[model samples]
Target: MRVFQLGLLSALALASVPAQADHHQEASSQQAEHLDAGRWVTLGTRAGPVTSATRSQPANLLVAGDQNILVDVGDGTAGQLAHLGIQTAGIDAVFISHLHWDHTGGLAAILGLRAQTNAPPRLKIYGPPGTAELVSGLLASMVPGATAGYGVPGAPRADIQQMTEVVELRDNASVELAGMTVTVRNNTHYSFAADSDLARRFESLSFRFDLPGRSIVYTGDTGPSAAVEDLAKGADLLVAEMMDVDDTIAMVRRNNPNMPPQVAAGMERHLREHHLLPKDVGELAARAKVGAVVVTHFAGREVGDPAHLEYLREIATNYDGPVVIADDLDVF
Candidate 1:
């Protein structure tokens, strides 16, 4: 399932810049992997909370037999589902990778839209500890506007309270639902000191979904983690987040040229520790022996960015498996 390869040395700084000649290689090979019926489809691939012209924030749709599940509900998730001709009400459950806005931004929309139509008994949402509180806050903020149709004359009342259910998943939690076996593990995305409040209050998670004959692992924004590798071991597909370290630093510099040295250094540290570089991603996938890797949550990748080919080459250095640089709506 491998695509292209390179014998070039691992050059991070130089690899950040796009090469005009590499665009054709990407175009020719980008569609190498195709989604079979009832498989995974990438709904959004962009990282960060900000919306970009190239990709959506971070979301994916999984069709396992009769079940329709959402991996993460990022911004524009509803629209992407509509674009894919999937009904919002048909989602059996949503797995929130973490509480980051980019991963949970479309949650309210999902709740509201489904309630607008034939609401399910309860839309199950699984996430870390703060999920209940987060949903409470969202509902509070949507008081007047989102709840306006609750009791309109000649319209069926929508039960905002019972319309959704939040399930907080802890590390090592395993469950069976939606015709799949779901196992969860905590990842090292939010790295804070053990005694710090941030560490105590925030948790990042990765999920593994096992169907009858296939397994998929979604590594929600994380640095290199043994837990993630173990969870994704021998998976049929690994959907992961990848960042270009050099490009990230360059992007920060371009945005804030006059930023303080300490602040800039901190930004670089976060990029290195909080996100996966292409090499790290490749090595992780290789070590896990996953059948293929579908890279989402692109941090510094732009549409038609030729530097992305170098990224693929970097991944190929370690992984001999297929690496699909996913765009919004790409299915595999």
Candidate 2:
């Protein structure tokens, strides 16, 4: 196994960093040192839409050669990018795993910032079906700003339509972009039956990125899934989302004290059915035979916390490969 370095921020420091801080200089310096390597930067590791002082939302930066692709633009992505000294205009493309808000919340910032800077047009955004609709809505929401560019009367407004191009992917879809072959497989994040209309209309996807010397598979957000396992087979790295079922449920209940029993039960069922547990990750990694695992999209405990150590132990049960409980900005 190859050695990898953690970000400058210790797990405890990362967990203690004020969520409101604009950026961390230490993290920025560490990221700068790694700018030349082909790596995955865990820009945001938190799961769900809930805010956290310790973690940002789900997002990742795939630095492959000269291409800077965003795997998932969750909320706070823009700010996180700033920490790495990356301008929004520097992004070459975006690959969205699913349409969940927590996964796509920062897309507006990406689009808006790029447009404002007059970056090259047609910033490609790839995702599952309905992606075009999502982008269209975001463009619509930006009309007011586009129409009033610099408060200059009659100045040519930035054309939102020309600023972005959306490609909607489907199960077993493949595309080549930025010198990488990106493939998608429908995962178990959504429970709808294959033949149902809802399933046709909505898809939760897992992606495998094959770059020059490395391959990384991202299990966006999913439960136990054969398709995901198949997609991740023999990859150099598997960047997966993991959940602590009980802790997530407790967090939800605490946040919504008024949540009725049925509602809470339903939410718990969804969490259990739509997300991966540590054991599930271990099983997937073991079955897929991935080279390594970097766990992100944290849902329960902060990395380095006592409980977080148990997560590694759980994964070690089935997979003996290296496992990392990633914190934000960690590069691998």
Candidate 3:
């Protein structure tokens, strides 16, 4: 029942340009020392594929006992890490909840940067069945850069394949990762019929991380899902995505005024069924009985808009636990 917001000091220090750069380097070193203590940092909180003026895309960093794991590598994730005084090469592993472009857009940057730097301890990417193919394609794209080797004549070419390892996870899969036990459940983001080939091929997953002294469940992007609730049950923290259905639909219509009415209607249905509204989030939190909730992956409201507070109010109606509407860089 306690609530706190972190990264205030970092935010203040980052406001100054020259001073911030120096401080960031110092902080990065300091952060490395305490990473084994375990914490969750919301690297990017904005929802969907479109960029925002105030928020970055959907990404999070999980620091679990000497492991730096990226929960989702959305676009701008590398930049978000840089802003927090962390380097892309520092990420040891990544857990992708789904294969949506918005969730996996930054994989190229993470892979490319790690390859360019020739960092040791090859990165491990854990995701759904198609993840290997996704990483394979990204690795193929890096061949030219690896061959160039910064224009150094006779220098050994970087082996991009050696720099990354992909582990594809399926529904109800569990694995040990860097002293943490990671489990995943298939969620309702995609409504493919069970027992169908499409269902077997594609899945949207919710991940539960059981770390030393803490348990966290991340609902990547899902509708109201009993599987997600079961995955999150009794967890220490539930980092869930929340959507403002009406506002999001409005934003979509505004952006595509020429879109057909039927198309818009279909989109609305998808948003309603495939995403969690504020109240849905509250109910899930309540049902899961998580100790605390940190809401990220926000959509449908402008940054600094008062209307955003309505989400908190709606969530409060069902859940009495500590709930935080997180911003980029917020740690919990």
For this target, which candidate reaches the highest TM-score against the unseen true structure?
Answer: 2
| Per-residue lDDT over 165-267 for candidate 2, one digit per residue giving the tens place of the 0 to 100 score | 8899999999987777889999999999879998989899999998765678999999999999999999878999998989988888889999989988888
Candidate 3 Cα errors over 4 Å, as ranges: 1-37, 260-265, 302-304
Best candidate, lDDT-wise? 2
**lDDT: which is higher, 1 or 2?**
2
Q: Enumerate residue pairs that collide in model 1.
A: none
lDDT of 3 by residue, 1-332 (tens): 11143222222111211214454575675554544436778888989845788888999988776667999989999988887667888888999999998899998999898887768756889999899999999999989988887898999888777877888888899999888899999999999888999898989999999876567899999999999999999987889999888888888888899999899898888898999999999999999888888888898665478887788889999998888888887767
Ranking of all candidate structures by their lDDT, best first = 2, 3, 1
**Which model is ahead, 1 or 3, in terms of TM-score?**
3
Per-model TM-score on C-alpha atoms: 0.83, 0.89, 0.88
lDDT against the true structure, per candidate, is: 0.77, 0.85, 0.82
Q: After superposition, how far is residue 129 of candidate 1 from its true place, in Å?
A: 1.1
lDDT for position 255 in model 2:
92
Model 1, span 1-332: residue lDDT tens:
11222111111111110112253455433322221223577788888744588788799878766667898899889988887566688788888989989899988888777866776768788899899999888767655755556556666566577777889988899988866789999998888897999777778999998876467899998999999999999887788999877776887688778999999898788778888999999999999998878888987666478886889999999999877788787655
lDDT of 2 at 87: 91
Once all C-alphas are superposed, what RMSD does model 2 give against the true structure?
Answer: 5.7
**Candidate 1 residue runs with Cα over 4 Å from true position:** 1-38, 150-156, 252-266, 302-304
CA RMSD for every model? 8.5, 5.7, 5.0
